[model samples]
Target: MGSDSHHQDGVGVPDELDRLWTPHRMAYISGANKPADGTPGECPFCRVPGLDDEEGLVVHRGEVSFVVLNLYPYSPGHLMVCPYRHVADYTELTEEELLEVARFTQRAMAVVRSVSGAHGFNIGMNQGAIAGAGIAAHLHQHVVPRWAGDQNFMPIIGRTKTLPQLMDETRRLLAKAWG
Candidate 1:
């Protein structure tokens, strides 16, 4: 259990049990949960503002919230609307933060539609770790674009995803559309 490749010779476990390894989400699953002290250094939402826009992949910067391309995306043009503050719960957001987060989310949808021609979107957040949140300590709203044939066998059969555009290119296109 300690190591990633710790499996028996198909003896102990049943054949019905399947495992999908997502090593990319390790940075969030392992590190982000431990920063309940609410320190800025440990919170990625807090740290991103200090970096340049292109380096951070920030699509648009609002007064109290900002839209950034998801590092681990479900689809192309996947975005996260996050507050500048390191608040965890949705109820914790100030009126300004609340307003900006919602406004930014709306703009994100439009940008995705214009830039990528997305058929639909999945826009929500997993509140806590038990609720499947990778970074439960900081609040972030996911805006994932969905298409007709996105749910391919690659994710199920092969544990891999094929993105249509590079993250950097997607960011540039979204940023342009945001304007």
Candidate 2:
């Protein structure tokens, strides 16, 4: 209960929150790992659709928008609803893209809930770089499945998040669930 010499060591006192050393995330934040200028031709959102649905990890392919798994997910069953066009801002979406994005967002919620048995959901968009959008150049809506006590020290302390299901496995399952 009293102060120890170890507490006086260079390292600070440990608190309840564990540390996750996500060093690589810095590359994404700085736009060093993605296309240089964030143009449509160089964008992943623009390129993913050209690949087959399975290859793209796409759950559903609507007319203007699609649902795909988040490659770096905050949790299992995390999906993103995005327009095929490489638009950055939500307000920039055309009426058709807007409608399809909404529809696919709904579809993403339903499919993830049915397939992953998620107890709840976290749904939204991080509009810009300052708002924690990794790919701020693309407009995408996140649909994250939540179970009770999903938060834990593994991701927090170990810095390694373990998703129970492989992305391809999840893609197939969600694709089936979508249908």
Candidate 3:
């Protein structure tokens, strides 16, 4: 066969595209669960507070803000600190809410390090949809744990992330460590 020759396998016809099946991302991509009108009644962040810890994947809850595991995690211990209010902009936060969110972010970092032995972290918030906020209606600070060589070829080349642990288990560990 020549170098450019193609052969058909039993599975199906070969194509130029490389597909990685990640059905879980459809909801996010399709915006199926995004808030209908960017209000507290429709915002998932607002609704999350009402659910229990396991159900919500909540690591810690403070007076004004709370920490929850990211459903679409960048890493095993990725988390988000969000205020209970349905405000979208950072400047919308009250003094108490701002302080609590900052405090929760710090606690989340400490708890994740203690639980997962993370070497470092990426902490920030995406301001708007243009800024890459999946849910631009709500303000959330992302805390993504980083290891020495955690950035592997899978995510870069194959567009896949290998999470070593499940969200519930990670949440349990961090919650325990936080308290």
The whole-model lDDT of each prediction reads 0.82, 0.81, 0.86
What is the TM-score ranking, best to worst? 3, 2, 1
lDDT of 2 by residue, 111-168 (tens): 8888878988899999988998777899999999887667565556654455577778
Q: Write the per-residue lDDT of candidate 3 for residues 1-179, one digit (tens) a residue.
A: 54334343324444434454556667778886688778888999999999999999998898888999988787889999999988999999999999999988888889899998999999999999899999999999999999876766555565545677877899999999999
- Model 3, position 91: C-alpha lDDT score: 96
Q: Candidate 3 — worst ten consecutive residues by lDDT sum?
A: 2-11
What residue runs in model 3 are displaced by over 4 Å at the alpha carbon? 1-22, 152-160
TM-score, per-candidate, Cα-based: 0.78, 0.80, 0.84
How far residue 116's Cα lies from its native spot in candidate 3, in Å, is 0.6
lDDT leaderboard ranking = 3, 1, 2
Which residues of candidate 2, in runs, are more than 4 Å off? 1-33, 152-161
Candidate 2 lDDT for residue 94: 97
> Which candidate has the top score in TM-score?
3
Residue-level lDDT tens digits of model 1 in 1-179: 54333455444554452455546557655664356665777877888888888889999998898999988787789899999988889999999999999999988998899887899899999998889777788899999998765656555665555676778899999998888
Find the number of clashing residue pairs for candidate 3.
Answer: 0
Candidate 1 overall Cα lDDT vs. reference? Answer: 0.82
Best-performing candidate as measured by lDDT: 3
lDDT, residue 94, model 3:
99
